[model samples]
Target: MALPGRSVMPTLGWRWLLIFSSIPSFLLLLFYSMVPESPRYLCMRGQTSEAMDILEKMARVNRVALLPGILVSDKRIELDENSDPSEAAHLINVGDGRSTVVSELESKTGAIMALIKLLSPEMIRPTILLWLAFFGNAFSYYGIVLLTSELSRGSSKCASYPILKHSVGSSLYKDVFISSFAEVPGLLLSATIVDRLGRKFSMSAMLLVSCGFLLPLIVGQKEVVTTVLLFGARVCISGSFVVIYVYAPEVSTRFLV
Candidate 1:
């Protein structure tokens, strides 16, 4: 998919490719400012009115009215040791069955402890597991993609194998183009079910399902069969890869709390 962009502005060569690659990130930056700050973060900073304004904007944009009891649920928050209780500060209930309140804004003194806590016993297991999952998912996904042509060629020992008779090499680039899209359906499937399936279970299921697709490759199957399995594995890995990112932060947040 990215290969096609290099042909767009031939005069600039790789520069055009760089620009094309960066366009998505640049557009993300352009749209990011349009998003309101998290109301919880606003409450943490003692900016209750601003948070309420953002919630109102959100409700108006979504064409829904705010729930009766949850209009910022205004309250005071102290920002520092010397701060007054009556100083302008507020809390907002975001309908998560919890309200954001800032008794005191977190001081800079605990920054080191916060970083160190990520390696503590409660966090160590989940953090390490998520890391391994991400590493394996990326390694297999790119490994399959990069090895498609080589896999198509097969071992010379397999040259004598009847299943190796097909001439898949000459059209390898076309296969790459076709294989690139195999991840899209997986991405869409993930987006559709992730919330309903729950993060941890979905991640585990996708990983296992992808591994199932990889098993047939050990038999040195026919080129057509090999390609199909590889594409299937890539699709499953891509979906798991997307979920793992969402799942990791959830793990970290749950542990930290």
Candidate 2:
């Protein structure tokens, strides 16, 4: 991001950084349109043949040939994890002929109903907390980046400090570029330890650490120290941000599933 900003900010201006940063995801979204829908969803929609065709296509995609007659079972069985395999109910055929489990979605009890359910007493607290977690993670992560230029330029106020005397924009990009390395370690730590600590706990720890690192900056500090602490804070926030993205979807299943 900083590299692209540094390269393009001259003509396109700083705002262009957001555009350039988003180009990859925008292109990915465009490319995603070409991808097939989940086979399970197709079966749920009662398009068993299409779902089977997709499964076959997927089997071939990874250089694995599907058996001449075998197909993916798209039937959803309502069974507890502890239930015996022989006790599986609603089993459906997945072969040349599909026994699809078509789920009839009630139109009247769809999106609006889901929204209403979300606002219900049982869900309201979790939903609001989830939003606050997302907001805090994003706020602190970007706050450091946004303040990088100003924080680094504190040297300009003191003629005696030569190490931190750089133009705000350029210094910002430089600090951001350097601080960005923190995300690599942060993400690696999250990936390696999140499972052990559990998602919620890991997120809490990250948020605490992020806030902890930011405390030094609240009181006056040298530009170098400020930049380093800001980097540490960004590191923790970035790690928590990663956890937050995965956490919402996984946790939402408690309500939706």
The model with the greatest TM-score is 2
Tens-digit lDDT track of model 2 for 8-81: 54544456455555666678887887899787665544567888888888888867877677444556544466
The Cα local distance difference test for each model comes to: 0.68, 0.71
Give the per-residue Cα lDDT of candidate 1 at 217.
Answer: 67
Model 2: colliding residue pairs: none
Over 4 Å off in model 2, which ranges? 1-109, 155-164
- Candidate 1, position 87, lDDT: 27
lDDT of 1 by residue, 50-167 (tens): 8888888888987898776643434434457775433234333233333332323343437667778988988888778877988988897887787665665554343345435544
| Model number with the top lDDT | 2
**Runs off by more than 4 Å, candidate 1:** 1-112, 155-169
**TM-score for each candidate, following the candidate numbering:** 0.57, 0.58
RMSD to true structure for each model, in Å: 10.2, 11.7
- Candidate 1: what lDDT? 0.68
